[model samples]
Target: MGFAGAMVVAMAVDALLGWPSKLFARIGHPVTWLGGLIAAIDAGWNRESDPPALRRAAGIAGALLVIALAVALGWLLQSLLPPSWIGIVLAGILAWPLVALRSLYDHVAAVANPLLGGDITAARAAVSRIVGRDPAALDEAGIARAAIESLAENASDGIVAPVFWGALFGLPGIFGYKAINTLDSMIGHRNERHEAFGWAAARIDDVANFVPARLTGFLFVLLARKRSEALSCMTRDARRHRSPNAGWPEAAMAGALGVRLSGPRIYHGSITDEPWLNGGARDPLAADIGEGLTVYRRAMLLLAGLLAILACA
Candidate 1:
């Protein structure tokens, strides 16, 4: 079986079983393991008083070490299996944890379910798990907006990007990409402790995600009911957001749902006046989050279909 075939099987398994809770309780998720390594590096090396250049160098070294380890682990797994169909199945099993389609949907649903039930506090608490923003201060609209934004961004990072790399370079590629993403999540920020130190990790993540992010936006446009509006928002507003890669799916999502996103918001008690995508659109409601999930589901299905076709070809 080819890499694309393995990807299809892995995605199906993820959609159906979603990292079984029993298994996870016994042996945590891949990201959790990766996080431990990243945290250790940060604690050991990311000193607040270190010179900016030295800190940056240390961060880069740590990121490189993590990437090498991930790749080596992937290679070791693949090497253990005979080069046959069984190897492909084992590869799919190993690759399954790296993709987050089911987990992402579940997390978003956790927020939407509470909001739909009219429990604002529960909604805020659910959204806090997926976002860094201050959740206690959020209203219903704020909670809904945060959930939708996180869904869009993570759909790209947690789903499409992994599939893209897995299809191209098999297990090693996907694991390496996950390492980059994990490093960024742990240390990539503009805060005083991370600004200089995390520069390399942030930039590396941006580069790794560049193509996959755009592909996710294209999938969103295809699935969106308002295709023209989604495309227009992607073209006009994607570059306006802070990150080079995040805005693509976010803009498409904003236009698809006809709800504005990425406006002024509080993060860790600081308010950032970010540019709004689809600025004139309506503020998101609980129903809008449901609509966004519909779009995300369709887009994921479309991606699976495409991968299957390529595998067949």
Candidate 2:
């Protein structure tokens, strides 16, 4: 199918049913099973006393197997159903599990409302629900900063990347992407335990997200009426991130909002003094977090419109 056709199908499904809870749970519920498989594979490889290259190869092979399983499941389900409205229904079902637009807004609102109401304690508690940071010590401004940063980062990871993959290759693409993302969230890390074992998952996620991240940055620029500088922000800040992909959308969001992001912050009691992006912009506020939500929604709209237009063409 053409890109436009795929997008049209994807968007129509998104609008009509949002996400099919049953389908997502049915298709995605097997990570537990897959995780066990990977654990066994890793343990077997560990006992071999192999070279680092061999161990890395085993990890990559395991990751590939997990991806293959998801794709196969999606394909198998797609084949069994009648082809009448199956494409749209299946696409919707797949997309439902993949996107989290409503959930994202609700999560941010949980923090925004409480903070605006002058209940710092309530606000901290709410922010902690979505962010991994320590909420106990955060003041009003700190809470706002954390919420805004989380929203921007999630714009790329949670929203754009999945949508892009779904558009590119339909359910299989989205499923594959989500599997990689899930693996990354679960095990991909730089900490001592995951540094070596989770290397494959992290690296694959980095590669898979590379183009989507850049595309998402462009989408943000277009939505913000600053298309000219969007690419520049993407180019400049793309390298600033250790992950190689997250910086693209973060920088674009920072530039669009005219607020700095990516500076030093404490994670799990340790401080990461990462260089900041958009340092020249305004200090982030709770209001900016609200504005970030607006930008996120607009970007989603632009994507939907693009999909519709592609279908039209």
Candidate 3:
């Protein structure tokens, strides 16, 4: 199947080049394009005046439209390519901007370096770019926990999930998945404006990510030094999270690193009292963020290796 080959090519290209700043400045990235589309749809269709049921129905229609458009565009592009190995390579290159491999590394490393230098100020500033929590309230342990959790969860969201879909149905699959994810990120929340309007987006995102999230957790468990600990923690604590899919990777990372994560934090001026994963373990420090990144790297490499093996077979 072209699934393995196409995803491998996309991952390799993204790792090597990282969608250079110059190129991004000129044309922006594909995800940004998707975001813009989602924003436009949200603004137009999701009316606050509408009843809850009407808003929900509109939201569902909007989501289906975006997904259909993305899949259609993907099919059109894929069809224009030469029907050979070159087509697969080209598809991967086109898919490169969709994968956020290098960006994830750079983002987590930004938090870790400043944190290791004892610059809590700068570390908090860096972490705010990736996490939604109130950065000012975060001390060293809080900062480390937020960054590590973001890294582990995003490892599934930003990388593995896309690759998993790409590996299953090639271009159209990946494109449709991204559409669902972007819609969820844009409007899928419990706030007054989005609670009803974003229900379908959230539910679809959960279903789409269910398998990929567990696979990402499994990859982390396989690469972690404390393999049994990671497995036990994941099996024990994954379902307790607020998000149906995110807990798998976060719990696995917490158990693998022998640290606790996801206790409680401030979001939008209110405290969300989340239960901890690996709650008995010590709090994670800056060094553990680096260790988390190391495991992330190994898991990604292992995924690539498996893809290569499958491609050859």
Which numbered prediction scores highest in lDDT against the true structure?
A: 3
Overall lDDT per candidate, in order of appearance: 0.92, 0.72, 0.93
6-33, model 3: which lDDT tens digit per residue?
8999999999999899999999888889
- Residues 218-292 of candidate 1: C-alpha lDDT, one tens digit per residue: 999999999999999999999998999999999999999989999999987899999999999989999999999
Q: Determine which window of 10 residues in candidate 3 has minimal summed lDDT.
A: 1-10
RMSD value for candidate 2: 3.5
**Top-scoring candidate (TM-score):** 3
The residue pairs found clashing in candidate 3 are none
lDDT for model 3 comes to 0.93
Candidates sorted on TM-score, descending: 3, 1, 2
The all-Cα superposition gives candidate 1 an RMSD in Å to the true structure of 1.1
How badly does each model clash, as a count of residue pairs? 0, 1, 0
